[model samples]
Target: MDGTSQSQPQPPEQTPTSLSPSAQLDLAITLALHNWPVLSLAVQSSWGGPTSADKRDWLCAAIAELFTDRPDTDAGDLEEVLLQVMNDEFDVVVDDESAGDVADRIIDLKGKIDKGDLEMVNKLWEDWKQREGKASSVGLFKRVETNDEDQETDEDEEEDGEDEDVEMEDAPATRPPREVIEPEVDEDGFTKVVGRRKR
Candidate 1:
């Protein structure tokens, strides 16, 4: 018997051209979220419970829904959504203001998608793939050990210590419940309501 190698059929690669506008927006949102250090830290640390990964996916859907409901959705609205979700779902208060940047990137990508420009989406997808490949090869979320002396600074030690010592505590037993605002569609068929939770 002659030894001959046969190549196996490969699965179809998902390119930017293959995705619909909605799917492109969803992928853009996911890439933006993953690139955010705060959200990445939260997921890596399991801040949103054991299903933190699922929560991130849910966030992508929620953000996509906002765009579907209102094409004119801006960064301010998206920032509020990011902040609210971080506070409620992950019990994390993102005071660093990085959420605004993430929101802006998402909105920009959305606008590009609306205009049928998928270049940025394709770039982000490539970046994500490269990052994921590296993360898989070498553990991306490995915890680092630092000595107490190394943490000490010349500035206000107390303030620095306080900030660094902050840990993720369990959510309050009696916290205000989130109120879901119903969408109010106008004559133009655009939703006047932005999904926001009352603090």
Candidate 2:
């Protein structure tokens, strides 16, 4: 009880700045958007980051703040770029993170989502889908199935490939001259190394 500050509430548990490296990049990139100057001022002025963990949470909160203010203009590219950067840097050799923890966190974001306060995070999801291709897309804590539209598109591609194969088989053979009468070996003991070169 003595450790507790009487006037101030205890801060949340210290998570990594941005929770993960990718999240860090996403937050920074998202802040650079148009409303960034205004948003940055707000975050810097209000958010007290005595610890590194607090700094990240603050950054994310700032971006969410901007998104809330300017939803239409927010394309979510910042999140995608950061995620791409993260993937290139880190290998996904393990999937050992806890699902329950993930779900809990996603639930926590729901209130923000309701407030139109989740932009880059949502954009990150779209980018994830496009990058994963046939495997489909996923959200933060959300596992999305890559829809049948892509599958149907793939099937169309296979059909086109089949048509191409048929066209190739049906086309007449333009190649000719499998054999030729060597022009008397150019009067030497060795065959001529030049002249058309058996092309």
Candidate 3:
């Protein structure tokens, strides 16, 4: 060690205290969206057109704006917005009831933020940063299909106690199989490959 060497001061630990209430709310919304498995799958699979990623960013801003514009917004209102967005933007009808849970979490976070408590927001931010860009292990949901014919058949089977030995099978897939489109060449001779659902 040199005699004239001096120790450098370490930076202070980062905290959410420096963020404004609106910004904190925005962060909470973003993190909430990130943790949503349905939205994650839609974005990963590009269900919302070619700009699915951009749509997610737009959703975060829109949600934050909703809270700002209407302070009385509750979990129900949030859930409606989430459901509409999924349907309109990603062509996804969310029947798993996870939207309500996500809305509740966001509403709870906003309430805490209103009271100047940022602990939850900070923890979520830290967790998101730690796992950014990583594939989520959360299991995806499957859509249930039902019809009058199937229901009548099920009832007839149940009446005779003939359904007892039926083994449960895997749920039907939620999405159609994607087929890669033929590569197209641009004026600059660049090739673009696109994936679309097989009809």
Candidate 4:
């Protein structure tokens, strides 16, 4: 046996004032929102903007990336942090069910984004916003079609109101189907369709 025993090295002491996961997440979200233009855009896109769901998806991905390099991080812990920070930062109330879905999407998008070119993420967001803006406005420019035959039938019924027994010979013969009416463009650049005429 050796006369002198070897001593093990001491581990570094951890500070007692370290931030909790929620606090850390809060700080991260705050910084990103303020300093990162893309994150701010992502947050804005979440509010009924184009590719809203996709933006949310990317946001979760970015959040996942934030903690991926940290030690002792778990999916559930990350999700809890995400839900708390998102609720606080976005000023929106989300139910537990939706939080779970958001967490799942975050994990999935993180994996996909990891495998692809990160630069494309911003481009994708911009393109989606433009495309969705135009597509969503389609309803404003498009016109709804009405069946002319139905309208004509309605008119005839009104003309024969109380004379259900009117002589068939005296009554005008059934007319051919009315011409298909096209929508007229107004001066305001909107399509104007004639509404059903009242009796």
| Best model per TM-score | 1
lDDT of each prediction vs. the true structure?
0.71, 0.35, 0.71, 0.42
Can you rank all candidates by TM-score, best first?
1, 3, 4, 2
In angstroms, the error of model 2 at 69 is 30
Model 4 agreement with the true structure over 111-138: per-residue lDDT tens digits: 4444543333333333433655644323
Per-candidate TM equals: 0.64, 0.19, 0.61, 0.28
Estimate the overall C-alpha local distance difference test score of candidate 2: 0.35
Once superposed on the true structure, which residue ranges of model 2 sit more than 4 Å away at CA?
1-97, 134-199
Error (Å) of candidate 4 at residue 56 is 9.9
**Cα lDDT of model 2 by residue, 1-199, tens digit:** 6797677675442221323333333332332321223323323443222232233333344344344345442234334422332232221121233222332343334444445455545554445445554233213222111212332454587677654343233222233434665655755576755464321
TM match of model 3 to true structure: 0.61
What lDDT does candidate 1 reach at residue 30? 74
Rank order by lDDT, top first? Answer: 3, 1, 4, 2
Model 1 over residues 63-171: C-alpha lDDT tens digits?
A: 8767766878899999999999899888899998899999989989988998999999889877766768744412211100111122233125556566533321322
List clashing residue pairs in candidate 1.
Answer: none
